[model samples]
Target: MFKAFVKIAVLLSLTASMAFGYQAIRLNVSEGTYKERNDAFNGILEVDLEDAGFTPKDIHPKIEYYYKLFYGTKLLKDGKPNPQFKTDYVGNLDNLGFITISNEEWMRELLMKEPKLGSFAPLNYLIYKKKSEDKTYVGTLTPQAMLDIAEIKDAGVRAAFTEKIDALSDATDEGMGGEVEYVEIDKLPAKTLIEWEIPFDRGEDVLDAKFDFMEKFEKAFEAEEYIIAGKRDFAEYWVDNDLENDKYDAYWVYSLCHFTFSYTVFNVWEHPELGASAPCSMYMYLDKDSSTLKVGMPSVDNWAVFGKITDPKRLQFIKDMDSKIKEIMTSLGAKEI
Candidate 1:
């Protein structure tokens, strides 16, 4: 009876082994002649999931999209895995990589200990070469050959949503320009902010001109309560008002015409009441080559008023503000350069 039972156990083991073929995938690495020890190294490992009866199309759609976005179409044949059809599917593993291991290996040593989830999808498996000799570590998936495609899809969807939000926020320009006035209140102490437009032929000259302007502006506004901010490339003069504790900030940009200048001003505290709650106080763009300062207005209601800014009232408001700025610059002895 004992001999028969042992024979049956061996037969069952053989049948199971035959049902699932075991194969080892090997990857080779080499060090280049000019390679530095501290420098980062990168390489691609071509995996044959076809042997396991899997194809790229079986991967979660979102993971596939991310993979394409990062690595491009180098791996996919005609934008998809070839061999047409297969019984097994290549499972998405959170857009990190594909799971080619089987379920039996899920609870194995290295994979089980390593935490696999990451916000940024892993593009390459980074390897560190030991100082003494070259070493390679092999890592495997934990959940086995069969994986939860839904989990990977969910992570991909969440990442896509986050990227969309970031793009929206970056495009948003709140408190750029609004219905604002220059109020010279007598009760408030006058603060002087001097800006300069200097022309330079070379890069070094540009730095010198900027430094020279800061020195002169500092002397001109030194008596009043002022703060000198920014480096030589561009600088700002800020004056504080005691009455309402309002601050007047002025930024100067190089104009298209030589020695011509353009500037923008804002009362930091008062503008917030105008619904400008941007983390940045202001934005200024200068075309040094063209000598033009294109002052962009805050698009606080940009999303709400997009494509509708063509309305007569809105157009007039923008034109009026532009005219006012030009007039102010003229009064400050700034010729339109």
Candidate 2:
């Protein structure tokens, strides 16, 4: 049994070697203490990304979207979600948060050109404290990794994006008072783009009565045991607020959550920090000049790799999620591109 396990591990290592493309850049501060609701007590530090003449607000003025994931609190209050939730809490970790920061207009336009780049945008900063340990760690997914995952070829855009994120990184490091160190690998596992195209002449009504795209999209996932946690319409917000009125013909992102899957990952796996990618996002939109509605999402496998998930079982589960997403896209008349 030991020999067989070793052989399997060697085979998996070989497979990873052949497909290396990106690695994670992690910034960790291992000294600090965080109380519950860190998002509320830890005030956001204002940094000037544009003092050097860069305008991030041109994309989306609201730069930072902060949210706290009180994983411990949730389990303590509601022991009904899963059997594991009823387990005694003997861990040192008491609080956690996922901070998403991005210049939407800047990142969104780049993502529109290369949908795969969406994997790393809305960059995440993880904050957590262990009950047994006094130190709180604050970390981020490096800009370099995101660029590599997207295979971004534009030197100019890559430079600008990297510079923008570097500024943010500096601010975060300073705020947390943690030295930056990278957790890296020579080879990156395969990351797939689950995207499909839909033929539509009228873009605005794709989600309206004129088409069944939205209905079919939802039904397909529902059939697969996924539920719509919610939806965010960026276009509607822009129009209402009179910000970038003509930027997009239509734009929205759907938040998908599988209760069982989430329970296994968050509660059983005990990796609440992975909630940084929670409510898996899939975005769809129509370009003003194009009749086709482009829909796409970065594969969940990227998260598995970045999260350092080496267990074959867990990796396979992530792949299955990707396959399921592709199936839904196809069911909605979207041809995989």
Candidate 3:
């Protein structure tokens, strides 16, 4: 009892909350090299996950986009780096990578209930190692944290979502045998998301219109040097499975990342775990018979509270990103609501 008390006291003393006094990232540390722990995490998932599309990219050169996310086609860059602003910046970490994972069947059930979950449909399995420390870290934003950011309150949705998240967490712990730590916080900022809507009349076939819209969406962001990191189509999944869901005409989400912006925050800074919140998931959906296409994403301003990033320069960058994203959305005809 005394030992547990001492550990809690020491842990609390050693830990500091990020921006909003809550730690959404859950860290699982193991005593091994990056390769060993990474292998372990993968090994455990092989049997459990429906399909693990392991898109892992190594970062060291202050980096480039491993792949640009395309809307319709899975084919983006040929798994090659997309060039962005060149910097002499060298990564201080040895191994830094992001792998998104999810249970597809479980996720499909919850999407109609809480489409906002797309903001974290595929949670980031962030892994990193420091050049100075001989340790490996694996983590993701906690299920509760994702719920908070997405503002989902359905009890059924919460239960199912957390069940899936806990399973993955257990697998991670089982594979990487080490200390499980948390970046703890009590709550997030009052406004956790930035959102907008683009109104349109779906003439005859909405499918063709969606395709055209996506092409413009992809090109516009790419022209601005934003990497479309990942994408998922929830409505398509239901169609394949023949699952009857009447909630929406279409639902999909995109993970966006600015190469230079990420390089500055993760590689140049001490907190690679921030990647858990990353490759920011922006969701677009149109309800059944609804003409307004709704778009929403977690606000980067929340990073101030979530990341506990106090540096003057870094704070400005996060603020600028919030502005930049809103600008891009509005430019694409999305009116901020």
Candidate 1 deviant stretches above 4 angstroms: 1-204, 214-328, 331-337
lDDT of 2 by residue, 1-337 (tens): 5434433543564466447634365554446445433442253323333332223211211111111122223343455543333234233345555444444555555654555454454444566554556765555556666676656777776887777776665555445544454545655556545666888756456446323566767888999889775555555556676666444566666667675565456445665545545456577777665668777665677667666888999989878888877777776778987
Write candidate 1's Cα lDDT for 1-337 as tens digits. Answer: 5434433543564465455532111112234321331121111122322222222221111222342333333335556643323233222222122211111121112111221211111111112222233432112211111112112234444454334322221111110111111111112112111122323233355445445544554444332322222121112221121221121122232111100000011111111111111111111223334343323222223211212234576555534544544454444334443
Task: Output the number of the lDDT-best candidate.
Answer: 3
lDDT at position 312, candidate 3: 92
Q: Give candidate 1's error at residue 87 in angstroms.
A: 84
Instruction: Write one digit per residue (lDDT tens) for candidate 3, span 1-337.
Output: 5434434543663464444356577787777766676677666555534322222332222122221122112433575543432334454676667765554466777887888887886667777777778888877888788998999999999998877776666656656667777777666888998889998568888877777788889998998889887777778778788888788888888878887677667766666778788778898888988899999999987667767777898889899999988888888889988
Comparing 2 and 3 on lDDT, the stronger one: 3
Sort by lDDT, top down from the best? 3, 2, 1
Relative to the true structure, how large is the alpha-carbon lDDT of every model? 0.25, 0.56, 0.72
Show where candidate 2 strays beyond 4 Å.
1-23, 36-41, 45-92, 108-116, 201-248, 255-263, 270-279
**lDDT, model 3, position 117:** 84
